[model samples]
Target: MPPEFVLPNYVLRVFTLFEQFSDRLALVRGERKSTYGELIADVLRIAAGLRDAGIRPGGKVLIMAANCFDAPALQLALHLHGCRALWSAPITSRREIDQFASLADADAFVYDQTTELGRELAQSLAPMTVRTMAELFTDGSPYEISATPVPDSVLQTSGTTGDPKLVHHTQAFYEQILELAGAFVANGFPLLRHYSSSPLWLASGQITSFFNLFTGGVLFLTDTWSPEEFYRVVSTERITSTYVTPPMLYELLDHPSGEDVDCSSLFMLNVGAGPATPARLRQGIARFGPVLRIVYGLSEAVVVTAQPGLTEDSAHPERLASAGTAYGDVRLEIRDDDGKVLEPGQTGEVWVQSNLTFAGYLGKPELTAETLVDGWLRTRDLGYLDADGYLFLVDRVHDMIVTTRRNWAIFCRPIEDVLASHPAVRTAAVIGVPDPVVGEAVHAFVVTRSPVPEADLQQLVTNTLNEMWTPAAIDFVPELPLTRIAKVDKVALRNLYRELHPDQTGHDDAASRAGEAR
Candidate 1:
């Protein structure tokens, strides 16, 4: 057997290099910039205060804060001091905080300010140290702590269907920081100035704050995602790299600023968190140059596969729909329902094996066992591999819609892809709803630039696909609902469909009648 994986001791030593790179800019938010030395000093001070406040090795601390420079400093302090930190998005509700508090077995709850709900959560988590950042940052005697072998972080899932799952990351996850940092050194720092608007609690937020800092790169942090602000930053700051979810990407592409902004400085615009359509990929390449990099990953598995750099003129523009080949010690396989691996070109569940695979969901062994089997993470995402090893995602297993009208199965991704190709449509999402005639009917929600008759969209799909692939009814909306992770929330869309159509029957007739009225 291979030697057991161990985190390198030098992980903490990198931060000490503040003595050498003291004057270099390490973090930038708006007009304010913090040099390497300043960042390290702040982290040490906050850490010392936390240590004085009884936070110790093996203790779990819950950090609920918005996007800011202080958040990353606090996380680094917690990790260096051997404490596991759970960072929940500040937008999380009090009831959700209670769930996280229980799962983390938290020793403390940290927040910026107090609210009615925050107070309620604090009261429920009695005996847990609950303090504001100001209180925790009180001046204290200098303290030094060493990293331990315990897990360093807890990440929660997007929670589309049920309660959000808690994903734990061991020191093995942190060790990758060194590996990635080394790669940056070798590659001459491909991503020097990065920007991200993800909240401090989510995984996307952690990417820019931790990885960029680890590589001695500058990070541009933001509290919220705004297209206008994003455009101004990229054009003015010369941002070389950034990350955006599918929905956010759509917004950026559709924003008028995208046409006028000087985004030529961007070298890498990593898009992930959900599937992106081919049309959007092409449009992004046109607007942002050839810097659109498609990343496919999960909260459980940090980085599974990524399309390094895609352009319209690339070797496989058709492969633009495919999540590129795997990289960095990751192993991928497509498997069927019986846990049997499938051959290339056969669609099935995508399973991954990687050192970065998370420890497991916190406090749910059965769920963990179901997800992680034989050291392989069952991604639940349905996809296949090409002969060249490129992974093509179809749809989430649960997102597949079966049509009893023709006794055939319909995948929402392909339908949505065709819908996106339409000139009038900006973004589209497809979900299945109950129908008396057909067991399940395909329902579509779309955002369009201009009013297009419903028949035009249906005709577009009909021209591109078979009869069964057509949507039973099309509902045009200003925008689609998105989860915190920024993926189109099909669950919420389904709820909205139920609300709009109370009886949920006669979709075809409903469409015909609506057409007549129009």
Candidate 2:
């Protein structure tokens, strides 16, 4: 290990807590239960192993693994060894993984050998130093702890828009998490027995794992996710907190066994990664009591805003659609195209400044510069805050559907929300498709519990907004395709639309058409 590289004080403090809670359960994966003492031992052993393998401080180590018993320990060990850990999800395509490996320019690769992808990656990235979980956990001399060079991490974006970018986070990000964890405990929040399938590659997973462990709480890591399995775990293990996307929440609400599930122990069920329809939010409140917490954040800045214990307020029933107030020390602003701050009730791009903000996009200085302007991170999400400071998201900036109808611009969230309000509609996603008449026409994909005519759904949008905002075509589907992170895959939806209508070639003329209409 490099002489200057040492573990941060915050990390040492967390490890001290682990020792204090030595015999207490720290991690659960499948039938495996690891106590805090065991976790600390594993971390130290892994650190010593890294040193023995000649992996020194500041070395960029690429990691590909599913959520497992050893993941948390491995991550902590890497940090303790003062290595820059680059995390990649096994759920993504091999091609993407290869690209990520190339982009990271890592000196070594650490993988879980149990997975086929891990084995494959290990074989493919030959000649490079590769270590498995078992090899790292082998009995070895515990690594000495000191205090100098801070460790960092590289996380993969959710890839909801397109190709995933590597998000760089310095030691400061982890320090913020420790502070947040302290605040969470001090504020009288429940000690989280967090159950999540989100992998370490994601920012959400990083925060969830670190926050739970920092507070000396049990983290239940899983690779597979289903409503039934979720209910079973919650009922059996008495899970207090968990994270899910809107789609997963809907599935839970729609599941037949949900009513009978013993979910009273659940204190906080975090719903995030995408917007949840008000109708489904109401259903969740009715079914799970006041445990639903609507969270809104990006990989660049996690936990930007959160609505805890969501309920249908009689005075502000529309707040159900809101993403809640700014969280922690975040400074939020709604800025128009001119970069001027907009007053409450004006829809604009959301920008935030906070300690939790990422360092930058690894190797993409241009993108980093574009996203992080001055001190604020432009979220690229179109939303507005009300008088009471609740944020109501409209859509992504790129997701705005340009129409020739009076040269109007339309957002998908409002249309999707309208469609979701229908009794027959279960959930809906709207995207822009190539159209000669309207430049970029609104196309909706809907999942329904019962059959409903396309005309009725179109009329719902028209009645809710106007005829101009109605979807050009509505496709009834069993379920919307989701990205690896479970966000509605709008890119896949656009491709599906193109596949269905082979005649529509390109939206090459969309910009000209839109301008001519103006």
Candidate 3:
């Protein structure tokens, strides 16, 4: 299937949202709450400021801030006023921040001195003209902003590679993608509200925030991940729906009284930073109830597959091991090495076709040609569909490791499940290496429990796999490197493993392995 060019009509306009839904709670930012009316007022002022600052329509405004109420509000303001908001996550390393910031041609950058690196970024953006929320409010272009054609959506690689092309997503399609999600959430509740802990530079959570804002929903603020704090929000804020990574889900499940936390008010929860184990899904279902939704899509296409109502029985059935079915308006195909579509239950590279997909790479036409062929976006992930239309993920084609014996994801489902179930292992990734005997042997990387015992943990895997699917080696790690999107950065893991062990992997900390016994 080739890409199609049918533009979706915009239903929810910014002006009407401001007028009809005024004086309602629009954003909750700790001690500072902003009503829709107040939010609109600020946005209008900011728009006026951008215009006053000589920022014409299509001029870029880079947002490098934390998860505050002002962040989403600023983005909406820019969209309303016909400017592209290049939303960057609160980057830490100066090298990373400068590297990405240098890539964009912008009128202004928005950030404050709240963080050490952030302050430095603010200084760096001074030459490029950075504007804080306070400055935007004082600008005098106060007439209501008019909508324009879609602006550019830039996609940055998660530093898995040194340089990544900016994926070109127009504002029109990006907003529509969010609108679809918000519409799905609003079918039951009076208003759709979403909360995100990760910063906006990460695409999924950024959309979750905007989905709540533009489509008749409130946006709440949480700058970073904290299980205990999230527990408070579920009860105090009466939060309805949330999107978080699997690691954060694990953190929430481990909070003191984490199991007993009252989250009955929640309508749905989206978790997609990475793959999950059956036990992790079961634990989430038990903890968050049936409202949990597992999303399995790379940043390249936003989302193509999802298993809402993430339950032990449905998405993670004992025998199925599937990532669920296609989203609305999205079609999926699993293709083999030669790009031939595979049959049901056959594994191959997964490609997707959908109205909700992105346009192309911003400046890279060759890369765009390679990715957006005809209309299909060739996702490098390997997966298969069952007879029932349920999709099962295999692994990345690039990340796939082939030893003499077999080809495995290295961090695919089986190993993720087995290790997640390990009492001492909180998170793990499996990699394959050259083996003289078995052709290829499995090496497991684990984020073990505190004071884990190396020998006991090794024995656990030996007991679990028992020669049927045993790893060539087992290594214990303090933590796995996570992508900015929050998924396990397997690329980084492979490199780090190569460095630390050089020839072989390390064992788990013997004392830390004791927690699994709990």
Candidate 4:
């Protein structure tokens, strides 16, 4: 059957199917299993408890926990009441938590951590109620929850606007998601048996868990990713569809158990959170068979596009660099500064409109207006769509490094794709620094295959890019720093480099950098 042209309401959601299939297994975490009946009952119990605790319609609740079955149910309860939730975990440092907690101004917070510190901080916070998981479960008749009319533009923006800001979504947002997920399940959505390693608080885990619950699949999760532990889980439980980031995939492929672990049952491997390099994408396709799926999305919206099957193109050979064709009620446009659509081969900001886009930012109205203009959220990313309409990303607009000799973005992805063309260099990121003469000299932070001379890497850069755009120095780093969101934190990188190399000088652009470096 063909998909419907329009979806119903926000309340008609991704988890509605689970209400009937009461006895099936839904989630597996550590040593426990949550049946569909158990999951549903828990949702009602938790929602009732939250309502009793004064959580009402239009309230924001903070859920500080990982991707346990309860976490998803708690989120459902919040949604059922037309309330929003912010997922919390250890990865979300206390500082980030305080920052988001302050921004959300949530009426209450649910602390999942059994640690003393988690309890202490929640207790200390003023004007906000705190409930533990035990409390959330044990208490019945928590409150009088409401189902109100959610606005069409009432979507929250994920961190797509360069800054981690909120944005709005239509009332029919999740219904759009359910379409794709429901389709996948109808066509054989393998129950995930070894998914114990998702980034608990974020959308990757959240979306995967929601899909599992709706499709009658099993979802397992872990606090941290471990190669040995994952093999044990997959072998022991036979997890079929798993969500993994590029780096974690690299870790798994390189793991000793990677070869020994039986992956015949591993049906669907969803890779996103960041763009996968052509080489890595190829490697994944080869090792995992054709079961790889690449999703392109931001926290602000559900997945904008996903290709169930990815293939290598001989002509451009860069098809692997693409995020893939747009999918399910999504619009992709490359627009210039004047809002003019750019021609193919021309670079511009990527703009997307989807039913899944969120309500709006929590506290920052100005930020929300700037991003969600005229119902389109302009992703502050620089990229060009191929003639075939495939999206290819270059860099974050903010992450671009403006220099004297070269006016280009410092994207390690292109370099990684090009370096993967070479035999010696393993992975890399190009950081830019101000120089007295050349203006902005790019420093290549590299992880090498073996000991390679700096001159060789310099030549490689010169060969892959113009001499002007070539990296000035190839500095080997054992490991690059990552943000809580897990992308290479260039903001932190620039600060760290400037602080250490103060004599090197720092400036915004070529002219200012020239004076400073001089």
Candidate 5:
């Protein structure tokens, strides 16, 4: 790690790159391209427009838009003016938009006119000052603003439930992020041309986009994700690096266009947001070469661990299955429920102490207190560290299903992994549903190329593990509902299960009936 060099203000650090990379192409959206000089000018103009519209420094502004040329500029303007920019997902429901708008007490709502939802939000929030991107960049007026003590930004969570929590990031956190980027660049991290398909609201996309621009790389922004389009962008633009969630990576690997796409120019393909099954990881390696970097992170703790290169030797082949070691100044520990730190190879809840962690959940002081303790953030993820210091995630602590038969705790990832290993299975999700017979029954929802009998899948898990760990019911679905960031919507599946069996009656051959409608 490089010597700690912290900036009092985050935007000041960003501005330092302006003079050097001014003429370089900074962003590319479809056919549109903008150089750093032009982008900085537009950012200032937008800031002036926002100021004229009654947005003041030290206030919060909600920005809702898809990937576009204006989105980054607006975010930069917010930071440069010392306003807390809150990024709301474009797919957010009207109710969520209203809730978040009210919860954040935003001074103004800035949106892009490209999407219907963005336009609708602009109209509905008319009572508050709502300005479209087109309206914000009307003047190239230079503006001068200084940073304040307020946080730099807020990231909204993509909770499966109707409610999403807000995580705050202070200016210190932003400084640390830029410092890490500088350190990585000094260590020969590639930054030339990058592609980002994730929505701006997601931390995964937001972080990557920031670093790419800060390092003077051209970022290819896309509103929608298609494996074919991603590959086409990579080959045509010679994209050197990109970030893909596990689900998106699966799509890229399975897409027919992937077979012939020229990916030689790609140097780094980061896999993050969720764990990638060993089978899928290997398959990705086969398709994208060994450039796959496994990243483990969450909304609260930006990035906990990342395995950049998969050079696992025979001595520690299991390192391929690990989430890699700690990142930067992050400290990792596995602790039992009683707050006892467990030794290596002991499975427990993961705790992290890091500057990368968010300040805290917005407005939920009690909840934040419960999570952040003594400068350590409770990750709530169940994992164990091996003797070689590789971290292996088992599952979310709350996601563990406890069977009534023997009061045994069953982690869903292992069962899901076994099902995914099946030849016909394309993607598999294992969720626990409430049952009268068992404390919680394991249910599997699978998307496959061809139909396979539920009994066969049950036997596969049974043979792999024991019968108790096998799914109580299996449902074949054409597709799984994804959250805004593309992770499996387990909450939706749980609700669907309840909706199907409202009475919680007997299974009544649920396997066959599960696919009937839902």
Candidate 6:
């Protein structure tokens, strides 16, 4: 017989905090506010329900839901019962949901009744026990916390690939978050009234949600995201911290009521998930005071680097382009293709090692082996560290454009940055399109606040970089396509470009020849 597994001390500590702050408000969803007392009781009741349902300690339970008041308690209950929680958001396509369901191999499926996708998945993923949130919480039993199997989780990536990879994390990940939360409190950071639209299925959401709860702070969960709602909630609730992607931040800045909003209560506005243009960052700084904290991380390693209290450094104006230095016991290094560590200021892939790094990819050993090598996670992001230790990300290895101009490697971020620097350009995205002449030509999509001629934009890039890096073609767009998680969807952009140019022969042969000539 196997020995009994005990819940980690960190989990117990969280339960203890819930008890200590029983009457304190913990979660706010819509008009409903829940106290820690209610949250803890809900967790225990759900755990009892799981046990009554005959799910063993190590059983894998798949969950699909939107961000709601019940989500945090439900996830905690799953972990408390020693079940491997596999969480998926309901926003994905039906086909993608089916794929995720197939990959889950779960012993049971649980979902929120409010979501249409949840109802559809519950019907489709059958033969196994399927229960809605209401069913799971019905008729609570008297259950006590005891030693059980160690809990773990499998989270879906943000769909950077055709098939989203499942990232596996163990109790250690939560323990690290608890430690970080403790540090946050001890350091006298503002008591977070955190507002987040990111659900538990995403790594960003998990950190934001748990980091607040663990510190005995209020967490406001919202299902939808809009600039107007964000402003309303921040002002009304006095939200101290929140997170947003670059695209979302742009919307907030461009909104008509941005100048009128009472955002003085906000202490931290974490911007991450992708690069924000330096020009836009300056705008944010000018408006929000020094509250924008630029975070750089991925699902594999959540919170590797953070530039907190972002300000425009007068001596180093270029620091606006940096993602900041290593964060919280993280070891960051730049490595060449050969795996040799590069000197500071040398461009290469970014590798990170930290307690917060994920365990491995679920059911994909080959990929896990490739991504996690020798205790370090290969970020697959090209960047460099300055002599002062600031990290500057150039591009993703896959996003680089290999031009025919002496087979030069061109990164889209630099070109996008140059275009975004223009006063008229609100946001910009660059992609590499197939070109018979230049091998791969740089094509840009710009969303502008005012009319900007293509010639002027082309000349800006030419002056900022060089003629070789100038876009072969430029398209004016109302907005850029974003992924489910709000990062710029380059794949969709490529498909759009292809749709616009069915011939697929090339974009601007004259421009390509001109660039080659330069």
Instruction: Kindly report which residue pairs in candidate 1 clash with one another.
Output: none
Clashing pairs in 2: none
Q: Can you rank all candidates by lDDT, best first?
A: 6, 2, 5, 1, 3, 4
- Looking at candidate 3, the ten consecutive residues that score lowest on lDDT are 509-518
Name the candidate, 1 or 6, with the larger lDDT value. Answer: 6
**10 residues in a row with least lDDT, candidate 5:** 509-518
For all predicted structures, in order, the TM-scores are 0.91, 0.95, 0.86, 0.87, 0.91, 0.95
Number of clashing residue pairs in every model?
Answer: 0, 0, 21, 34, 0, 0
Better of 1 and 2 by TM-score: 2
lDDT of each: 0.78, 0.87, 0.68, 0.66, 0.80, 0.88
Candidate 3 C-alpha lDDT tens digits along 12-62: 365465577787788877789888788877777776877776677668776
Better of 4 and 6 by lDDT: 6
Give the per-residue lDDT digits (tens) of candidate 6, residues 1-518.
34548745356788887898899999999889989999988888888888888777788999998897798888898888888999876888777777777788899998999999998888887788888887777575687777778888888864444566789988889989988988998998878999999999999998999999998999999989999999999999999999999999999999999999899988999999999999999999988899999999998899999999999999999989999999888999999999999999999999999988999988789999999999999999999999999999999887788787987899889899999999999999998877877778889999999999999999999999999999999989899998889999887887788777768635556533333222
The weakest ten consecutive residues by lDDT in model 6 span 509-518
Clashing pairs in 5: none
> How would you encode candidate 5's per-residue C-alpha lDDT over 1-518 as one tens digit per residue?
12232224567668777657898889898889999988888888888887888887767888888888788888888877768888887787878877777778788888888878888878877788888888987664468665454446787784545776888877767677787878877888677688887666777777788878877788888887788888888888999888888889899988987979899988888888887787788788888887888899888888899898655457876677789999888899999999899999999999998888888888889989999998999998999998867899988887877677887888888888889989899889887776657756888989997878999999999998999999988888888887767888777777676676667634443522332222
For 173-234, candidate 4 gives per-residue lDDT tens digits of 65665676678667775555547455435655656666666667777766666678767777
Best by lDDT: 6
Tens-digit lDDT track of model 1 for 373-419: 99999998999999999999988887777567657767888889999
Backbone clash pairs for candidate 6 read: none
RMSD of each: 4.7, 2.8, 6.1, 4.8, 4.5, 3.5
Candidate 3, residue 293: Cα displacement in angstroms equals 0.9
